[model samples]
Target: MVPKVPIDLPGTRYHKARVAADALRQQLTQIIEERRIALRNGRASAEQDLLSFLLSNGSDEEERGLTDDEIKDNIILLLYAGHDTSSSTLTSLFKFLAENPHCYDQVLREQLKVASSKEEGELLEWKDLQRMKYTWRVVQETLRLLPPAQGGFRKAIKDFTYSGFTIPKGWKAYWTVNATHFNSKYFINPKKFDPSRFEGAGPAPYTFVPFGGGLRICPGNEFARVEILVFLHNVLKNFRWNLVDPDEKIIIDPMPLPLKGLPIKLIPHSK
Candidate 1:
């Protein structure tokens, strides 16, 4: 979508985006106020979480703390950047695994090994996470096939030439992850969901960037990885789920999502 086009005029998609942003800011403002009150009354532990740390400036009085509005803005930024990407990836991962029973079995086996190593009611730790090699490959392949971020925009720092085309300096450029992900030069039978491709050295640098590449790569990449892996480990250990719509098509409304929302039926694992 040509979002940069001067289409913010009423009734346009740009206008709609602006309206949605305003609504979100208002909601975050209210939440920030509630958090501030909780911190003052000891209702919520200060430095307990990101919001608290932001408010307290890492418990340092000398360091300047973020203003209430700044804290709210950051909360909005993190939610906007991190929330949907991880959720969509998780949904797609499960959907694909359910459709490919072999992959699901492999994932389940790997997770079982980790689960058995831990005592009953024991939580996953860093060591257990390190053992999730196959599951991580599945995550990698899922990201390759269905990247949560489709493309990103970057302003050209200098004029450049590629494929016999010259791009002028300061011109904005868009890089599509799908093009690289599916390129034959970088992958063999790119459409195939073979997590084995991730076993060795993996794809060339900058070629397999689901979180992006280089200096501007996402800062939350590690956080997202830990969150997804931990969630997957627990979910697989405790429950089995099946996609209600095996053939549900993914549609990208800016980001990829199932056409009808990825509905699933979950059954708790029997002892």
Candidate 2:
């Protein structure tokens, strides 16, 4: 997407984004300093979590240890890639399920089957998530239709030709996820929402990449999967919802978002 203003002019989206970024960086810096102090004071354990681990092991004497800024940047990336993207996918999933009753029913049935197998008040485990094939297919379809990230930028490894166009070895290229996702060559009736597309062999090797492909692919992809499936399982098992506006418009500010935040009326399942 292109910025409306060349500079961070007042009252512009670019300026607002800069303000938010600065606030986030400041907040993360404070948290990092507090954690570092706690670690030095023996008030926190190095094994507590990722932040603590990074702080504990980051020694200036070691050549490979991450700098404070590096640690902060990594944390920011994880928050956006792991948290924001998952939230977007979940929101879109809810909207789609509400619009398509048949798909909603199938997802509910699949989730209930998984729930029924668990003991009362039992927590969902990794293996339980693995059994949620159909539910995941639904999620996959959601990702395909409304990927959290529109796409990413990559550099050409070497000169290559595709569709008779030659790309230079070092030129930076931008790829759009929707373009690949909506291609009829890779997907049948690409505009249609079909979870069955992921049934067997799934979309071709590099085609179904909500998470980018190859070594540069998202590292938090599996974490997002578990997070999404677990949330869907619990929510579907306990509640039924209907979209307040079935025809809500999706707009991409950066990622796809409902114009009205996907307003919904939730009905709790009867005990």
Candidate 3:
């Protein structure tokens, strides 16, 4: 959880954060205005992207369009959801793979088998990603160990009882990823880096929720899986790397990160 700071405290990190946020808001406002002008001039298509779609479809016969503030807020949310989380997960994946040589070898072998079936210099396709079962399992294990977002805030829709405790309706709750991911009831020997846990039926439903669950689950989960797998396949096909600091500490400042930014010495495969 991110600790709250006094935003009014001058020269503090919180002050800097506020300044940066203001600057970003200004930038987004400018971009939105420019896009609005472009849309009016017929220089941009309404179907181009989410921003364009929102701009185009927001207004209707009886409803008003989203305000600039609303659009900026949503854009920020998407930026973090679609980009930051995946990057953090990828960072943790590299660290885990490097530490577990056996697991790394298995991932490399699986990725290579998929590559072998493709023509040289060919790009990976959806079917190719589908074939990377073991690699995806390894990624799942990594997520179990270190989920980027940790948890999220949710409100109870109705009173519910679990473990003899009653959560009253209208109460806010935070569901932690590690709480379930690390529970021995859901995972055997939870601390161990074993991807085989995902084999067959996998963990009980809602037990392994790195992308959240139910209606509130992240929409980009599949996209992130494809992104991570494709990146790993390409990197493993051409290079092997060793961490410069084998025992580097992982610190979570909202999201997990290697203390040293995970410097590595890459060893390219000989042609």
- Candidate 1: tens digits of C-alpha lDDT, residues 1-271: 5565566788988898889878988997777678767988999776689887676563233456676667777887788788999998998898888888888888999999999998988888888888999999999999999999988888889999999989999998889898889998998999988899898898888899888888889999888888899999888878778888888888888778799899998888893
Residue 107 CA error for candidate 2 (Å)?
Answer: 1.5
Which digits, one per residue and each the tens of the lDDT, describe model 3 over residues 1-271?
7866476788988888778878888998888888878988999899988888878877332278887778787888888889999899888898888899899899989988999999988899999999999999999999999899889989999999889989999988888898899999999899999999999999999999999998999899999998999888888998878899998999888899889999988888783
What is the Cα-based lDDT of residue 36 in candidate 2? 83
> Among all windows of ten consecutive residues in candidate 2, which has the lowest summed lDDT?
55-64
Q: After superposition, how far is residue 194 of candidate 3 from its true place, in Å?
A: 0.4
Candidate 2 residues 1-271, lDDT tens each? Answer: 7734458788988789889878988998899889888988999999999999988786443677898778878888887878889999999999888888899999899899999999999999999999999989999999998988988888998999888989999987778888879999999899899999999999888888889988888888899999999998889988889999888899997889899999899999893
Stretches > 4 Å off in candidate 1: 1-6, 29-48, 55-72, 268-271
Ranking by TM-score: 3, 2, 1
Off by over 4 Å in 2: 1-6, 59-62
Tell me the spans in candidate 3 whose CA falls farther than 4 Å from its real position.
1-8, 11-15, 59-62
Indicate the TM-score of model 3.
Answer: 0.92
